[model samples]
Target: MIDQLFLNNFKAFRSASIRLAPVTLLTGLNSSGKSTVLQSLALLRQSYDSGILMSIDGDTDSYGGFLLDGDLVELGTGQDLLHEDFASNPPGADPRISIAFTTTDKQQYGWTAQYVPEQDVLPLNLAIGPSDWRDAALFSRRFQYLQADRITPATTYPRSHHQAIGRGFLGARGEHAVNFLRHHAQDVVPEGHPLRHPEAGGHTLLDQVVAWMQELCPGVNLEASEIPGIDSVRLSFGFGGTAGLDSTRRRRPTNVGFGLTYALPIVVACLTAGPGSLILLENPEAHLHPRGQSRMASLIAAAASAGAQLIVETHSDHVLDGTRLAVKQGRLAAGDTAVHFFRGNGAGVEIITPTVAEDGSLSEWPEGFFDESENTLDQLLG
Candidate 1:
């Protein structure tokens, strides 16, 4: 697990070092640098995926660099990433953008890239760590980065053998989720595992997925199958009329409410992610009702308890409260959870961390940190 993340001259941060835990929640207002935290990690993963982050003996500068645009992230160019008017830049040295991570094992991996205004590939100036950093969970196969703008209700989703099957990667937007589900449906979520949903019909991956989805919409079950002779996979939903809807019919994702499809990847990712997994989630609460939003947080907590390191970027108070509840219920240790609220300063970002106590209470609730409902209620009462 990543014990800490450090960014220098990265977007919205001139220099910031954030202590992380098994489950780290990044919560704050719009554009307050919450997403930047996730993006920094994604940036490294994408670079590694593109063969830019690896350590090679040759001209490592030409052989390795930060791939700004790739399968996981599209950061554009160096100008887009570097902090605007960053306070410190050496006079002669090519300005560098640095992103570093410290593992729970006390090992730190730091990468410095020479920022070039128009270059999409920021040439690597230095890589600090053991030679084989790929062994880290960040580059390991058990990793998922589900972007905020996930797939909408679609009739079919892509089935990529190399991505969904070979690599076990659910695409950045979770485009490969349906195909992944189809392939891994029968896989068992091991017994005594925190990810094994108790209410699931059986231990199969699909069963756990359905059981978890049911939390969003009760009695809801889903199936994923290959569309005959096509490279795409199909997703369909079945309801048990719990909401007074038709129970007998199987409906495509489009026919159901938007929440189910949009949230599918999150459910699948959390359920299937085993120990040593690194999941970076952006806005898992999107499109979910308040209760569903909270339930997702509990699920996230469970995944973390199962030994997956999760860094979640959310704007939902329900998620925050649900995580607290998880701590109190003993699903997740309070010390293993870290909550950071980001706020915009003049040129960079400010981070305020609130400690979670064992009893589901926070050490401090800063103003504007999950206080919108009360703030609005105050306005209405006035």
Candidate 2:
């Protein structure tokens, strides 16, 4: 579980450090830098996974080549990136990215990566041992970051990996969701019988997911199958109606509503992720109905209860309500969950942590924060 995250001069963040919980909910207005936090984590983990930064050997000059072009404009000099710019008085005037997290074994680790504006490079400053890098290596595999605009309905199959059958690895745009489900179906159910194993908790998890999805569109059933020519297994959803039982049985995954396709990856990822893994989700409530959004919150909370750490960036009250519901239902403790509200001020974006009480009440509610209906009503009544 990532216990903390620090950001400097990364995107909208000039300098910020956020303490993480088992389930961290990031909510704020548009352009408040919520996505930036997640993006930085993704880039850092990706670089580590691809050996992009491992080859740097602590040399700032060698790291300059890897900095994004835009980041160079923010950092005037390459060498200045090494020193923390605490004196910068302007908003969004920080020049470093620092993140601190703890592994499952209670090992504390910190990484500070900054962009050299003059030379366009990013150098990594780590606060943990070389062995910790192995766990960090799994960061790329464990952490899954997604954007809202990128999500789409399953209108077509992805052509990149033809051998893909079921859910694919934390799929891009959730295209590999079905493939991932089919491939990992055994993991979901030990005996390979998903329906019959009522005693198995894992089966119950998947069944609840399928049942919840069915509530959205009745008569839809999900089943896994292996095609003879395909190298991977596939998950197909059967629909029933006047279209005929045969037609419903023959429907491909592409025919389902966008919500299912868009949400399937999130559900599968949470269900499949191992204990101690960090799951960073950007806008998990995107394209989902209020009910579906709430359901997503439940799923995410459930994942955290099962041992995975979840960091979600969302604008939906339903999502917020879902987490609170989890707390109320005893699935999550108040201290185990946190709601961080990001507000842009003269000094970049300020993060406000809202404490969740034992009774599911927030300690503070900021202005223009999840009060959409109130704002609308005031305008109309006026």
Candidate 3:
């Protein structure tokens, strides 16, 4: 697991070092640098995926550099990524962006990219690490990043053998989720894992997926199949009327409510969690009702309990409450969870961390941190 992350002249942060845990929650107001944290990690992964982050023995020409635009992220040029108040190298030199992280095993890795205003690929000035940085926790193949703008209900999804089947990627927007589900439907979920649903008919991936989806909308069954002779896969939903919906009919994703389809990738990602897995999620509670939002947090906590490290960016109070509930219920330890609230302070972003006690109580509730309901209620009563 990544124990700490350090960002220098990257987006909203001039320089900031954040301590992380097994399940870290990044909560804050809009554009307060919450997404920046996730983007920094994604930037490294994308660069590595494109062979830019690897150690190059020869002279650094354009052979190895940070790939700004790639399958995982599209950060544009260096100017778009460098901090507004980026630190200059010297009296005459240009600005630079630096990203570094320390793994739980005490391995420190750092990358420095020179800021070229018009260049998309920021040439690396230095790539410093243990040389085996790819073996690090965050750089492992077990990493999955699910962005906020994910696939909505669609007629069909793509079927990529190399991505979905080969790499087990759910896709940045979860475009490969259906194909992944279809291909791994029969794969057995390990026994004694938190992802293994108790009500699942069997320990298969599809069964576990359905059981978890039921938490959002009870009795909801899912199916993933290929469209013959095409490069796409199909997904449909069946309700058992347990949530007061029709049970007899199987419906395409478009026919079901938005929440079920929207939350499918999250369910699959959590169900597939393994030791040392790093799952980054943005707004897992999006399109979900209050109860469903809380349930999503439960699943997140369960995934963490099963040994995957999660870094979630969310604005939902229900997600916070559910995590607290998980702590109270002993599903996740308080020490293993970290919650950081980010906010703009006119100059830059400020992060405040509130400790979670064993009893589900927070050490502090900073203003504008998951207290909007009470803030509005007091005004209305006044």
Clashing pairs in 3: none
lDDT of 2 by residue, 1-382 (tens): 6677766555666567787888998889887877766766665555554455533234444442234323102333445434323434244664445555555456665565554556545666444434445555235456555556544544344432432332135553555555555555555333443122232324543454465455445555566555566455455566652212243455555676566667777776776655666787878887788988887887787678667788889999999998998898887898999799998777667888889988888998898789989899999999
Q: Write candidate 3's Cα lDDT for 161-277 as tens digits.
A: 999988888999988888998998989988888878788877788888888898898778888888999999999888774312235677999888789888999999998998899
Misplaced by over 4 Å in model 1 are 54-63, 87-92, 241-248
RMSD of 1: 2.4
Q: Tally clashes: model 3.
A: 0
Superposed Cα deviation of residue 231, candidate 1 (Å): 0.5
Candidate 2: residue 23 lDDT (0-100): 91
lDDT of 1 at 20: 89
Across 61-80, the per-residue lDDT of candidate 1 in tens digits comes to: 44478998988888888999
The lDDT of each candidate is 0.88, 0.62, 0.88
